[model samples]
Target: MSSKSDTIQVGMTNTFACSYLPEQQEQLLVLQENTLNVELFEQLLTLGFRRSGETLYKPHCPNCRACQPIRIPVKHFSASRRQKRTLKHNRDLSWSIVNTTSDEHYQLYQQYIEQRHHDGPMYPPSRAQYDNFIQCAWHQPQLIEVRDNKELIGVAITDVLPNSLSAIYSFFSPTQEKRSMGSLMILIQCRIAKLMGKDFLYLGYQIDASRKMNYKKAYQPYEILTANGWQQSE
Candidate 1:
């Protein structure tokens, strides 16, 4: 029998409104594999691809190249002053990795989207949306759960691959914004990747124009996929 990995297919999407850039359109090159594995996905990650649930895609915009795929070399990474402060501040919190999701996860996600992303496409978060956006159909992702005493404050949707961990999405209690839970969750992912002896932590894309989405570069010693291949930025 031919293996599902024998012949992989890929497709592209029509140009649409760019979610991050107001004046540009966006396009994507998507992988259409019937079955995906960590080894294959890690190869794709090195080529600047990212996952949204079960689908893997990379920006193929004709007129713009704002989406730069970025990843941190966990061994070479140095926390910035602000990121160090974030780590120190979040020391009181506890984190654990799990392969399942719960109502608590959905509740925090709903609250986060309703309060923080109401102006965006995922404003009216629903169970269906939550399932499609965060839960994968092919593989179960590792969810990093953070808590304060007994309260579930944050959840980071992460994909654990053979050589790296991909940051899919993260949501936290909007009331806990002061804790910088978003950044804290990312730091946690990095720590986990380091402990696992992974070489990189794929951080999706680094969009320079979007104030809300451009923070990925803050993780120093990250590499961005370029026409010349993965180039290190110090």
Candidate 2:
């Protein structure tokens, strides 16, 4: 089998203000190729690369190395007391997976960005932004939709690879804050990955300094990328 390093070409982007870290700058090592596919993404995911829309990139910051790629070893994962409670709490909701996006998805996503992330970079949500950010050309992303008696409450955008599942992004009805929908979606993804016989669930980057983006650590016994290789974290 040929290695990823042998097949892919990469280039670095100009430094920009870090989205997660306000005081830092961010740069990305992006894949420079015309033909990108899920099979190729599987290899990139193993190397700490992530997808935003259709672009595949990994952090290559100059001054800071705070953005660490994190993944859960699905077979070995053991949920904490809180996670178990979250699962129990949302047991009443229905979960289904689809391979396409809809206007309803955009409505919920817009509401999520506008209400919860107004102060963030994706604020003033527009239809164009949502479509561009979510849709991809190579493959149709999986939509894990959660509902309450026919009402849409949460959606988790995920990418399915041969050996792993990458969580692209998730958003919930802001009005359902008490449901802990965000964490619930993640827990659901972990379960789905295990059910699909996948080895890992890629939860994107874990930036310890960002309070809002640091919750992936609660998933016990995750592996984070390092200079040497993926290291297990307790």
Candidate 3:
């Protein structure tokens, strides 16, 4: 597989925005065993990246902190009445928290990619691509699958950080859109973090204006990591 790895000294001079920049200086990358780890994550608790529903990250660029992490504070979390309905909505579904990628799992992935993200890069993720997507963490293949008997409905990929559980990716059966399996998966992660006594469940960036990313904003009492500091969305 192709790889990109680097480690830089702890100075702003070595920093740069990766994906979100015309100018590169706001983000820093740390090397752990010559691989890129979350230097920004260390700043997450302070830089405004809130955990909820995958990874730790802040907006990197000339300026934009909308890329905040959305995390659930388990001890203080209360399932909203709507959230409760979402869980009960999928009660018929069963789950198995195992590793990702299997014959059954792959087929489900194929359908989800084909139906849900056809216009996106992973529209037709090769087996290799799918494998890589879930294999980057210490928890390689660590994931959960929501199924209906023999039918695979959705997948949630995650990693456990020092003080948090980070959700990597989640995709549900397009045919079962009414099920809201995506949100249900996050809800499950919140419960898991609570049981494990972890402080937060890290949901990746919550970009408001992007049609593909708008739903991320709903995972509340979310905190957005900004250049100034962590700010509550509402």
TM-score of predicted structure 2: 0.95
**In candidate 2, what are the lDDT values of residues 125-230, reduced to their tens digit?**
9989888877888867899999999999999999989999999999999999999999999999999999999999999999999988899999988999999999
Residue 130 in candidate 1 has what lDDT?
Answer: 92
**Model 2: how far residue 59 lies from native, Å:** 0.9
| Model 3 TM | 0.74
Which candidate, 2 or 3, has the higher lDDT? Answer: 2
lDDT of 1 by residue, 45-103 (tens): 99998887788899999999989899999988888999999989888999999889999
The most accurate candidate by lDDT is 2
Cα lDDT tens digits for candidate 3, 1-234: 243333333322245543333343455322223233444443445444432222333344445544555566666777778889999988888887885468777777888889878877576667777776565452343578888887878888766565767777787779888888888998888887788788877676665645666675566666555556556655
Off by over 4 Å in 3: 1-59, 62-65, 137-141
The ten-residue window of minimal lDDT in model 3 covers 28-37
Error of 2 at 79 (Å): 0.9
lDDT of 2 at 74: 94
Candidate 2: regions farther than 4 A off: 1-7
What TM-score would each prediction reach against the true structure? Answer: 0.95, 0.95, 0.74
lDDT of each: 0.89, 0.91, 0.64
Task: Please give the distance, in angstroms, between residue 167's alpha carbon in candidate 2 and its true position after superposition.
Answer: 0.2
